[model samples]
Target: MIHLLRNLALVSIVLIAAGCDRIGAPVRVDDAWANATPAGATVAAVYMKITTKDADTLLSATTTVADHIEMHTNSEQNGMMQMRPLSNVPLEAGEPFTFAPGGAHFMLVELRQPLTAGLRFPMTLQFQHAPAQTVQVQVVELGSR
Candidate 1:
């Protein structure tokens, strides 16, 4: 009886793992761009919307172009703009989250290389319940108001 129970448990685990794979198709990226900055002593922000069909979570991000990639959110403190890193963000089922400037965004800091206009960089994002998705981000020149 014990051996039979062990086999059942193993089968259950496999079923759960298989179900998770079909939970979401993939993460969709829209309107992605890296703003251009002046040469030397500058920082830039990335704006994009990550969407999924079912529930999922963003684990982490990696980019060879930047030294560090972080998930950040913009908040107003004492009438000043403040940004903080978030450990994780929930992706609701069939819901789209907007990541834009002065809001929830991804900050690429300490760029090892300069980000010039009309350049494309590769970035990879790992998801907790979905597969790791790599995306290409295009650099755009600074827009005049």
Candidate 2:
């Protein structure tokens, strides 16, 4: 009876230790910002820098202030600027993915309200490998960033 109890405790400990890795995968988000929107505007853009130790993908982002969020990239085509939507942002180990203006960014479509300068809003980010992280996105003037 004692032998069986000891084996059960060891099995439980092993299972818990294995789960800790999945629960705590390290992916870091930094320098997150959004440009403040003018009154009556329903769209805005967000920028950020992300780094990860393992290969990971940024699956989606959500905020209460926006009707929906989507990832987009800007490029020049035949002397005209074009915006394209991205399905996901994939990263390699130790490589930082940057989202910036006139480049890759998040589009906040149909905003609930204008994002005012000096305001910080909570945005939750979902990842392919690491756990979902909620980050506070700071709002700045349009030309300030």
Candidate 3:
């Protein structure tokens, strides 16, 4: 009877540990901002720095200002800069993922309206292994970089 109880306790501990692995850790976004778009423009870019406590992947993003949002990376191909969609962005534990001009950024397409300077908006970021987080994004001028 004692051996059977020990085996049951071991199974219970294993199950509890497996369940804990499914819970997501926290992530943080900082210095999030969007570039101001000119009138009649239908697209804009957003930049930010993301940090995670555990390994995770950025699955997608959404904002009320745009009809569609996706992760993009700018690369030079054939002497021309090209922006390509990224399916997911991996985040290393305790490492910072930076999204800036001329690098990885959020491509906000089909703008609902022109993004004006000094305006702020909410952007929701979804992750594969973490809870979705919403952050405030500031709109800066074209020259702000």
Candidate 1 local lDDT, 29-124, one digit each (tens): 777778876789445677778897668998778888888789999999999998889898899877888888779988888887888889888888
Superposed on all Cα atoms, the candidates' RMSDs to the truth, in angstroms, are 4.6, 4.0, 4.3
- Native-referenced Cα lDDT, model 2: 0.91
Deviation (Å) of 38 in candidate 2: 0.8
Candidate 3, residue 130: Cα displacement in angstroms equals 0.7
Q: Of the candidates numbered 1 and 2, which has the greater TM-score value?
A: 2
Residue 126 displacement (Å), model 1: 0.9
Question: How large an RMSD does model 2 have?
Answer: 4.0
Ten-residue stretch with the least lDDT total in model 3: 17-26
* Runs off by more than 4 Å, candidate 3: 1-25
Any idea what lDDT model 3 has?
0.92
Clashing pairs in 1: none
Error of 2 at 120 (Å): 0.2
Candidates 1 and 2 compared: the better one by lDDT is 2
lDDT of 2 by residue, 1-145 (tens): 9999999999999998888666555788899999889889999999999988778899999999999999999999999999999999998987889999889999998999889999999989999988998989999988885
Q: Give lDDT per model, in order.
A: 0.82, 0.91, 0.92
